[model samples]
Target: MDELIKYAKENRRLLHQVPEVGFTEYITTYLIYERLSQTNFNLYVGDDALDIDRQVGLPSDDVMANTYQRALDYGVPCSFLEKLHPYKTGVVATIDTNQKGPHVVLRFDIDALPIKESNEIEHVPFKEGFQSKHDGEMHACGHDAHAAIGISVATYIDEHIDELTGKYTIIFQNSEEGVRGAASYAKKGWLDDADYFLSGHVGTISEEVGTVGATATNFLASTKFNVELFGQSSHAGSNPQDGNNALLAASAIALSLNTIAPHREGATRLNVGILQAGQGRNIIPDYAKLECESRGETTQLNEYMFERAKEIIENGAKMYGCESKITVEGFAPSATCSKEMIDIVKSATVSNDAVKTIVDEVSMDASEDAAVFINIVQENNGKATYLIFPYHLKYGHHHPSFDVDEAVLEVAITTFINILNELK
Candidate 1:
């Protein structure tokens, strides 16, 4: 147990230093493969795990090139990168016991938030030398801990296969930060044979040591998108009438999009987080990009909001005489877990010595891509549930100073092991 804790912490620390976002997780994939190479698990990646055509909001080719080179320079070999190149860095590892039993799938997201880490010495990550090495990328949301726990659980399941009689599957999912990656895996029919599905996030519901929360409900369905507006450019001081300003089009859309009325059926949230336009101050901007997201308590409500927002954007673009393209990069449907799945999590938590108490509380005020996986599994009549592991945080999620206590990794791994043990 001590060794496992040490292993989990070390893995978390190592992963923390090499933060990658979404589909460009080359270093993450290579490290996972290298560690699990000798294991008996049958791994699935490349075209087998994802459909790149369906992938949304993928980084540009130049970004991929820089990311690849960055990982290579960080010690991830080209051979490993080559294996994942076709798949765009998604991975799924499976181990079957051959005997007739249930098919279970465990998912863990492996992506970092796009935020630079705070360099203050008081921040634990900086104090410990585990600060993110990459600029504008950090595991501020604790996915690093999630990845370590996922790998540790996979290793344990493989080593103890003799004691289990089922197909144990672990998915090291990428691009989950924007809910971009999970749908591709789901679209590929990975959940067709699943009898049970399990996944979890590290915080938000659990804030103290020795506490665990099972079964989140009322998850917000969401859609992430980028809208690019195009117009003709001209000199600012001369013949300005010849130019159409895309920046005005995008700005008008942002202000109007926010004013879209909320639905009475459920909660709705919208934000335009990134809006970029213009080149030189003296030149009329020909192009502008707006990155935005919307969420609702139900899928229908989200669609309603998105459709209205789109109309506003379209008309706004036309009002400014600019062409627009709205691209839906990712989406997650709302989900509620079955009682059967909740009971399984409850039983596992009660039987584990590490978990002092199990809380049934759930906060669904936010969105998670795991909703995609859960919905797919449930659609096929498989029971699915999401858990929340409790821990202390030095700063709130997505903050530049965000850091989680290393001990929660223990709770995460043991809870997973106990659940597998119960199921087997």
Candidate 2:
């Protein structure tokens, strides 16, 4: 455990030095492969075998080509790599134990956000002078840690696979930040065979340097929407009344959307993230587009809120005499933790003297595509749970200065290894 912790600390510093965003994690993925190769784990990359163009979205095709070539260079083995749709990079690896028992699936998100790195002195890559070369893309959400932690767990499981009693699948998922990655895996039946599923996030909120925070029982289900409005364009001064204002309709929808929040019980959230309209202020906008998200603790409430949003958009457009279209970009289901699985994780953590805290809470405001896994498990009549390890940091998640106490990595590694041992 001590040696693994030391390894994680050293490796985490290196990973932080070079933050890569989303499916464009060419260098970061290579480094992970290089590190994990030394361990007993059977390394696999491009489990879906997606072509570079389909996996990563960049402004330049040349860059995507190069990244795809680099991933191919690693030559990780897998059964298939589908090149069907090329927007996300997804990988799946299977570790089968000859012995018969329940199969388990574990997932980790491997994408970074489109934010700049902080210039803080304690910020690793920045202090060491290895900040991102690609200006705006950074691992502001601690995904680099998630990747490392997943690798550490995979390595540990690999070394101990001979003594284990079941099969394990380690998934390296891409595009979690944008909420567009996991659906394909779920649809492809990647998790169909698993009897149990587990995943965790590293948060700065727990404050306990190396403790596992709340075993969250329920997380809000969320859906992303892109709305486009069409209206007649006319010169503002010359013919103001001749134009139907799409911008006006969009604004009305945004304002009226907030009215639905007070109607829901528990925590319901809504946000309008992106808005683009008009070329010039002097011209009545011909088209307006807005991207928004709505979330709720259950599917019923989520659907209800979504229906209200639809009404707002439809009615607002009619009132403004403009045409409107609403597109659901993506949807992630809510997560409800299984008591039995939570007990397993809690028992594992409590039994380990090194674990400082074990929290049990029902609500986590943030949404995870990992929830898709939990939903799959429950649907299959299996129990599942998700855990979080609190790593003390000065700033909140998705912030530029976001940094985690590296010591928590050890605690996570220990907890994962212990859980695997107990299951064995």
Candidate 3:
């Protein structure tokens, strides 16, 4: 157990030093592959594990090339990068005990946020010399810790193979920030045969280092989309009338999207996070792009909000004589944890010495791509649940100074191991 703790902490810090976002996790993928290669699990990486046709929200070709080059410069071998070339970045490992028991699937997300890390002297990572090396990326959401726990769990399973029954499938997912990536594997039937599916996140509900939440309920359904408006460019000061003014159309759509009426049936939300238009101060912008999202307490409500937003965007573009296109970057539907699965988590937590409290239920109140996988497993009549490992945090998730108490890693590791034991 002490060795697992040491392994978890070291790998967490190592992952923290290089934060990559979404589908561009080149260096991150290579490191995960290298670590798991020493275990007994049969590994399926990148192109082999995920369905390429199901990928969403990939960056442009130039961005992919630059990130791939960066991975090379970071000393990652081209041989590994070649396997994940052009936007394939994740791993799936399976070990079949062939002992006549349930098949368990565990998921861990490995993507980072685009936020830059704080370099304040008091920041733990900065002081410990493990802050992110990349300028515009950081694991502000504790995914580094999640990935570390996953690696440790894989090693633990290998070491304790004699005592465990059934089979284990561990998924290291990428591009979870926008509720993307999981669908690729889920659509490919990764969780179709799963008898028990388990996944968790760190520190959103529980407030203490030793607390564990057995069930994360009421996940909001969400849709992330990008809208592009095209128009002719002209001089603003002279021939402004000749241009269709895509920037104006974008501004109108952004304002109209926020005015969408809330559904009385449930909670609803809409936001235009990014809107880029107008290349210069005096130029009538010919192109505009807006990154936006919609959320609801239920799937039906989310569709209500998204459909309304789409109508506004299309009409707003037509009003300005600009052509409009809407593309779905990512999506996740809402799901509830099964009582059977919730009991399984509680049973596992009760035996863990590192766990101080067991939360029967907590509201996620947010979107998670894991819901895609969870829904797929449930649809096939398998039980599934999402757990939460609470830890002390200096800042909320997605903040530049966000850091978790390393002590929580022990709770996470033991809880997962105990859960496996319960399945027997």
Query: Evaluated with lDDT, which candidate comes out highest?
Result: 3
lDDT of 3 by residue, 1-424 (tens): 9999999999999999999999899898889989999999999987778887888898889888999999999999998899888778999999988788889999999999989899999999999999999999999999999999999999999998888888999999989999889988886677889988888988884388888888888899999999999988999999978989999999999999999998889999999999999889999989999999999999999999999999999999999989999999999999888778667877777767899988888898899988988888888998888889987766899989999789989999999888889996
- Tens-digit lDDT track for model 1 on 1-424? 6666677889899999999988889998877776667689888777877767778888888888889889889988777787677437968888889977899999988999889999998998899898999999999998899888888888887778888988988888999888788878877777888999999988764378767777877889999999999998999898799999999889899999999998889899999999999999988899999999999999998898899989999999999899999999888888887678667878777867778777775776888888988888888898988988877765788999988888788888998888888888
Clashes of each: 2, 7, 0
Cα lDDT, all candidates: 0.86, 0.73, 0.90
TM-score of each: 0.96, 0.88, 0.97
Residue 48, model 1, lDDT: 76
lDDT of 2 by residue, 1-424 (tens): 6766776766666666555555566556566766766765555556342333322123256655655554455452221212311244545667788898878888887778778887778876677775555567677887778877887788777777788888887777777775666776776676887888878888846467656753675677888888999999999999999999999989988889888854436667788888889889899998899989988777666777788899999999988889999887767788788877666777766677768877775356777878888889889998777778886667888888777667778877888877777676
Q: What is the lDDT of candidate 3?
A: 0.90
In terms of TM-score, the best-performing candidate is 3
Give the RMSD in angstroms, all C-alphas superposed, for model 2: 3.8
RMSD of each: 1.6, 3.8, 1.2
Span of ten consecutive residues with least summed lDDT in model 2: 76-85
Tell me the lDDT of model 3 at 38: 95
Candidate number that wins on TM-score, 2 or 3: 3
Off by over 4 Å in 3: none
Clashing pairs in 3: none
Position 356, candidate 3: lDDT: 91
